[model samples]
Target chain A: MSFSPLIQQLITSLRCLPGVGPKSAQRMAFHLLERDPDGALALAEALQKSVSEIGHCKLCRTLSETEICDICSATDRDSSVLCILESPIDVLAVEQTGGFNGLYFVLSGHLSPIDGIGPEDLGIDKLLERVQSSDIKELILATNPTVEGEATAHYIAAQVKDLGVKVSRIAHGVPVGGELEFVDGGTLAHALAGRRSLL
Target chain B: MSFSPLIQQLITSLRCLPGVGPKSAQRMAFHLLERDPDGALALAEALQKSVSEIGHCKLCRTLSETEICDICSATDRDSSVLCILESPIDVLAVEQTGGFNGLYFVLSGHLSPIDGIGPEDLGIDKLLERVQSSDIKELILATNPTVEGEATAHYIAAQVKDLGVKVSRIAHGVPVGGELEFVDGGTLAHALAGRRSLL
Candidate 1:
């Protein structure tokens, strides 16, 4: 026999998550219902509040409650150096590092020809307008190392070739503390090819 | 800088799930806000709906919208045979197979002594009361093979040893598709010890 209608609906709804399937959905639904109803209630309230109130920041494309996100509106960041990233989560990662104080532009996603995600879909025109109107001197491409990320970075770099701004991609290398033998061949090759000379 | 209040609360609340950590919570919150707001809304609705409507079955202690669960109330099931499981998810697993025709009693969790769980905590008295009042001739202990699960099954079997019911465990053996070389030592030992005679 199948689950009750409510249970079945809950399981089906949970399948919309990134890695969850039918079995995992069922597990999550039962877990919420049986183990922690109060937690489930809190999750429900959080989802509703965030979905209804949050929207894309007009300047940076990061998620925000208002037209401008905190990062985009911060006064202390370096306005001359702009870092372009694929998503808000990446912004979080960069923020956690506390290394770069540059402003950010969120692309939301990388180009995928098979999936039909192109320049217009990522609001490349808006980014170009921002770059042209601002006093930006250096542009950092901080997108992932995937094929789509490379294509997006290349497209943006070509667009800004005539703008007389320094364009750079984040260095590719074996992660800090990771052994060379365990690193993938592609990453190893990139790390070797992009080696920097130490003074 | 941190996320907006709504997003932070969402990530915090999502962390209430079993294996979810700070990173996974952030990932889930971002996925809900960015990729599928509508699906997130549906999940929120489902959580609220199920949490408010679902309650324990009065007979077998499984989750149900009504006083009696669907399995317990079904007319075609064998009322003389009762299967005891650790959680409602186990009930769903058994139901999915469509093999067992018996009713089920859900313990919700196994006895974890270090965590302060005991017989009284799992409603063992309620299970005993039902066994005494019902026509249950056999009790199948379908809890997991963990130490806590074993203790729970043993406690239940001891409670019903004098009730003129046949108490048995599910089984211990190599999983259907798992190879012998890859099987853990504990599992392989159980598989060897519980070897059956081919008819």
Candidate 2:
């Protein structure tokens, strides 16, 4: 009944993924060894390569292979406007829409004191340095709508207010395809208060 | 918005896992590269090593690092009793129960004509060879209760009937925690048909 120690090790290693459990890890290990070893090899090499090569951008703190990220280094992007987000994934989310052509400053994570994460842990001082030193006119807070995200945003806003940078937040409202009846009270209230007038 | 090609490749390769999608892959890639590079490297090495080293057993067709699986090569297990199952995972399931001390033959998959799988696809001939060459007293069909599994079990039974081998199918019944009302009619029927006196 017991699998070989190596097979057991492979299964345990796969459990490092976000949502994977023991059963899923076992399935993944079996799949990698059985069905597509080449694909599995690619994933293996990719994991090592990405981990070795990828690092946080000096300016934005987003994932990059070099010292600076593409978005941070791009000449066309508006450096005068910066978008703040909880993670690099949010940067990708905003970038995919082509709606924001501004530079970004990734917090890397929200301020969660329970997890020993705070403003300092999120590198908020580095963000303040960018605002104080640059001609940045707008700092858009695009962190998640969770309590920690809101607290982090408020903290950042207060820190940058003296620098004369106009701080804004991405709107919180009912999702476009969501029904109002299913929407939570907090979201509905934000939607009502942040309502826009039609031209 | 597009990640580096290495990151992209990692994400794409992660999708090869069962139930993994674009979003989870991205999350996994980020978690590996960002949070735990050492653990990521271990996983990478494990994946490569397992894929390269692991192979099917010559006799039982279960995962092993050699020409034959440990279970098939073991002398302590009963050689006269053979259990046929649809996958190596099923072998683990049976072995874990501490019930079966017999030898095993893993089909790897069941008969699925729609997917171009047949008796040959499952290497039924190899199983037949084992049956013909060994002093097998009993053959237990432990395939799933699905239509394809049933068909596969029937096909196996027909192929071995003339060999004087006593073939038996694993019982079908309601799951342990399943409510009687919620149990499928087929399972309920099987339960009724297989009922024995509890004396």
Error of 2 at B136 (Å): 1.1
Question: What lDDT tens digits, residue by residue, belong to model 1 across residues B1-199?
Answer: 6989889999999887766788878888899999999999999999899999988999888888888988888898899999999998888789888899999998969998899988888988898998999899999999998998998999999889999999999988899999999999999999999998899
Which runs in model 1 stand beyond 4 Å of their true positions?
A182-189, B173-199
- Each candidate's TM vs. the true structure? 0.90, 0.92
**Which tens-of-lDDT digit does each residue in A1-199 have in candidate 1?**
6778888888898787777778778888888988889999999999999999999999989999989988878898899998999999999899999999999899969988899888989988998999899899999999888999999999999999999899999999989999998999999999999988998
TM-score of chain B taken alone, candidate 2? 0.96
Q: Give candidate 2's fnat, 2 decimals.
A: 0.79
Q: Which regions of candidate 2 are displaced past 4 Å?
A: A192-199, B195-199
lDDT of 2 by residue, A53-149 (tens): 8888999998888898888888998888999999988888898999989999999799888999878889999998888888999999999999989
Worst 10 residues of 1 chain A by lDDT: A15-24
